[model samples]
Target chain A: MNIHAISAIYRFEMNRMWRTMGQSIVSPVISTSLYFIVFGAAIGQQMGAIDGVSYGAFLVPGLVMLSLLTQSVSNAAFGIYFPKFTGTIYEILSAPVSAFEIVLGYVGAAATKSLILGIIIMLTATLFVDLKIAHPFWMLFFLVLTAMTFSLLGFIIGIWADGFDQLQIVPLLIITPLTFLGGSFYSIKMLPEFWQTVTLANPVLYLVSGFRWSFYEISDVSPQISIAMILVFLGICTGIVYWIFKTGYRIKS
Target chain B: MTDNADILIDIKNITKKYDNGFTALDDVNLQIKKGEIIALLGPNGAGKTTLISTVCGIITPTSGTISVGGLDTIKDYRDTRKMIGLVPQELTTDAFETVFDTVSFTRGLFGKPRNPAVIEKILKDLSLWDKKDNKLRELSGGMKRRVLIAKALSHEPDILFLDEPTAGVDVELRKDMWNVMRKLSQTGVTIILTTHYIEEAEEMADRIGVISKGRILLVEQTSELMRKLGHKEMLIEISEPLSALPASLSDFDLTLSDDRKLITYSYNASHEHPGITRLLKALIDADIRTTDISTKQSSLEDIFVNLVRDAA
Candidate 1:
């Protein structure tokens, strides 16, 4: 309800990102661009088109999701984590702002940053491969939902992590590997039948599949199931965050 | 105003027990009047910070309740929180933020509407106006502390808690902070400060509370505490060196200096006459000539140290 507090935290966090533009915005854009150059050009030639769509264009949705997922989690996690590390969180804790407002500010800003990067990467994809979104509205929906969900996950990681190593552990060891294995560069159908079944178990697969479905109308899984899975994940993250605030976990005591 | 309402902060039997079974606070009770400057003095880990944190809603107490303006801190958190501003002990600020932005942001965090004149006055009062546009990372430590003060005051709360506000500060800044506090007190803002320096309390606090080992040992008016518990000592320099005290002077609590030329007497300052005349008469009767005599009153530091030492 305290919109001013939320906006203050949001602006402060956004300002930090602006000050570190090279690390926050530029690095991710350039890295995703490299994925385009290496995966789209070099690897796309080796593999033929799948589902009548060129390999390079097919890689666009996956690459954007890959960056979106990783950046969302890391950005939100680091957003809250840095304040905890520097002890500035006390100022927030002692203020009149509620815990929900605090989360909204940090998570909202992180999601916005990740969403912007996702869009820029999408635009940059046009330079390498001719891509089209069959459903632009669905594409935007998936982008915002995925950004918010992962940003919530990042907020959890930020609170749960006690050190810098722990903060980076989830994004690096878990999110990145899962995103890569979830069909960022290749489709699940390309794997053996048994591996394909196992690959479906990865939650990142649903996210990427649903996002890819928006671009080419083709996915490893049904789009409806992917949306349902993301909503469920979002609910779980919201519940955990509520419990954290109620118990004052890592923040109060 | 009603009685309870006049009591700005009513802390009743508040206790905080950490999960590990360590009791950080034990049945601490205090009532702070509006517009009175109180100093909570204690050693590190004496629960000074815990008590303040509990009252401020940063840490919840395991038992009992705290009410600000008759509103429970937990049940009515937002309302009570809006009434308080806390300047924490740690010097924490966003390194990339400019002073004006950070201070303005803190005001917004309190859900207060923007008032440029108020912000400008606070900045000017804290002597931070010149550095308003500079990033926090570029400011000196003292300036950062001032910014903390400005942020706390930005909301214009009725009560302010300053936790070791002058720790590690220079002498000039310390004096300057004291002056600022005095000026604020004149505006009827109730200030409660926790400090390691007894001199700070002596200089500013209208009332003093001593907390040690999770218990509030004493809370008394500054003048009343000094009058009731303070001891005065008289040092008498004798014309002739004596190896032993005279039998007539044995009734007085006295100590001979190491050189044997000085006799020192300790007594309560508020007592009627303090028996100094009788002691001097005894000295004369005993043929112990006293060339010179001077008296010194014990400071709040002495009272604090003795109280803490005895409590331990």
Candidate 2:
């Protein structure tokens, strides 16, 4: 619970992002802008508003959550993987620093990046469409809860991966596909009945819908259900990660 | 066990067994005194690495106890870990980190503050100040090894474990590393190193331990061990070559050279000494004149091979 170690790791990760400003912060903003233009603004002008809200408004929260999820997971995975691939994990293991400190350091930094990217993507979406937060409390709550959950997921993935190729497989095959299928581009209401029910099974749908619910006050699923699901997912992922560090499974052995 | 000083490390009956049914270390007991640099010498698969890793808490022992600075390694990991720094054999370092940040980050891992003065002294001592800003990836292999040493010393630990610190290293850098170790020893750092190079122990260590088959065969002071078991080899090359030894040569147990041009005799450790006058008179009685003779003292290699071969 000491903030000193957390602060040190967070600042170090932030500095790495700053060094790659184009890729980490700017590229995400540019990509989010394009999504708004093609999927929200341009498409909306042709097909009309979605669910009584402006197309840009409907896409805003999903865009922010998408960036938050990808960046948070990838950042944490790389942070832990680099240390291992380069053999610096030995240094961390030999040091007096505890496993809890390492987990906090890596996950805390991942959360910080996710938070920043989420905020920046939100602001950039404003360039394409006028936006307002209908429930300020819901917006802030989901933003943090969502970031922390994915960051923990990232820590687990990082520890599980041994090499660079192993690290890329999870994000590319699992996380990205889940995000797209989770209704980031279209609502489940636009799908057939069976397909809509299947879409409900996607965990990422809960995150995007929960965050979108905060912005537009309308969702295909209940906001409480998605929020509770996220917390449950967070608990499971944290348990797995804490167990890995405590047992020193692959990390130490 | 010498009780001349406080016990820095008290390792009792430690054992390790891998899942593959290979017992890497077994029931090993050792008492290391404060400020002593113990050289653990053994051949390949001798459990030297496993012993060091267990003491440093990198690998957990299946049984037994290890205490450093009077704190049990398993029960009090944090306290014991804080007092020790291990420089592993593999040259794995942060390639992207500059020399300064790498060591400073290691110091911070121990919860030490960013004292530029202390960091500067460590860098300068390791001869890394001029290369402080250079990234690890840019440095040569030897330089990277030096950086690892500097990082291990940054936190000012009481016990330092080096697993093969100089294997495959060039001669000049190896000497440089020994000099640095010497300086650290002068500062009262308890150093334990595992090496395949037996001469390293003869040159630097006060006490040498030979381990084999996951067991400590013997632990003794360098000179004491040598004096107790060492001997001289007397190789005499005669002026005359003979196909076979005469009956008078029976007084001396000797082996004929491959070409029958010389005779080799082990002069000690057999509880017997060959009388040179008797052998010379016997050779003269046989009308075989000796031209040259020389004797060489036994080396650590002789002692190591003798000890391990006997134990095996």
Candidate 3:
């Protein structure tokens, strides 16, 4: 199992996070807080309620999801990518650790960081809007699942990227825009019928909808479908990761 | 080449061909006995690093097999890797990591429990204990190289591979590194090093392997290799200048200087009778007076160049 190896890698990564606390913890917290002030306080006061909930409270889950997805992807991606860039990856590659343990260490640390950030953002939301949780267990479940899934995607991106520009391509170009359009600022129901159909195709919609349903019990799609979609995404990412280790993809050769 | 029981690492018919069809190693075979220092000497792009990397399990061989301590390197890599430590050629390290933390990190990566006492001894041995808390970036290149050695030794492996450990290092530090390697060898750690420095191989290696063009030309005991391949030259300074060599000297391999006052005779050192006495008698019978006579033997550098040139 090489449990010691996993613990070493995990602790090394977590130490890096603490060393760069401003960028890892402080920056995300401040940015999400600003989103709350601008979207939940200043703007929500002028908007009407949706699904019998205040507009500010409705934005909580979506906003937290938005940060969780981006942070998870970036954190895990950069964690692996920097080692490759610096040529320190040889130590990891030549070590006795297995591919599974390597992934567990890197992805686990990334998910933990995102999980902490998600909780902090949720706590920060209490300062701006009245929050409620109808299904606290499901909310925690969705939080953990979403963090782990995205962190796996981030680990893949880290191995796949060959340059700094490529590292940012997925998070900045794809994830951030998808989160914005995935019902972060408003409900997809407000869209015209045709647009609502198109929004359902966005994968981020499933994540946000599932998470919001756990909070307000109001969702654009059924909660079961959201869980299924996420689990399916998790399966796909796991398959790719397995293939990566087997084939010695960008990480090996 | 010894009894299988004494062999610690056995590499047989190993070849590594890259995707682009470049053969980095071609049918290489080697057997390293336990606690012996073997040095692979070659020039740049000679597959020295590739050979070491393959044995260390960093690169998979395109064909053939390697076994360390009777365990197949590919099938039992975890067990094999636990027995080997490699100090890579490049000085790649985390600039933000402290010396103590980085060395400890390598021990853990090898699945060993944390032993501050062991790390302390290694750091102190490498003269890095005083700088344990200093970041890697704050250290000089020599210090960083020592830290790399400390990391390799942190796990207390049975075998250590040093790839150009003294490349670009100063002479004094190179000698210092040699002393450290000698100390480790005394502790029964089987050491294999790849180097471009011929003197390093001659000075430290018990056996020297000359590799060229992805192939090993020969591996022999350092002293045996010198005696077998090395040639000797005798310079005879004449008491008076001459226009040409005497007819009696035609049987010998001789060359005359431009001034015609000095003659040089080249002979194979491996010969039981090098004809030095006969040459002196011939010179006396020819009535050629000599002012002085001295002999010089070829260095390992000369033999290495000739071997590589012949392989090319």
- Number of clashing residue pairs in every model? 0, 0, 0
**Where does model 1 exceed 4 Å of error?**
B1-5, B233-275, B282-298
The candidate with the higher lDDT, 2 or 3, is: 3
Better of 1 and 3 by TM-score: 3
The CAPRI classification for model 2 reads as acceptable
User: Can you list the residue pairs that collide in candidate 1?
Assistant: none
Q: Highest DockQ: give the candidate number.
A: 3
Model 1 docking grade: medium
Candidate 2: segments with Cα more than 4 A from true spot: A1-8, B228-230, B233-297
Candidate 3 chain B superposition, TM-score: 0.85
Native contact share for candidate 3: 0.73
Model 2 score (lDDT):
0.83
DockQ of each: 0.70, 0.46, 0.79
Ranking by lDDT: 3, 1, 2
| Number of the predicted model whose lDDT against the real structure is largest | 3
Model 2, residue A8: C-alpha shift (Å): 4.5
For model 3 chain B, where is the 10-residue window of minimal lDDT? Answer: B222-231
CAPRI verdict (incorrect, acceptable, medium, high) for model 3: medium
TM-score of chain A of each: 0.98, 0.95, 0.99
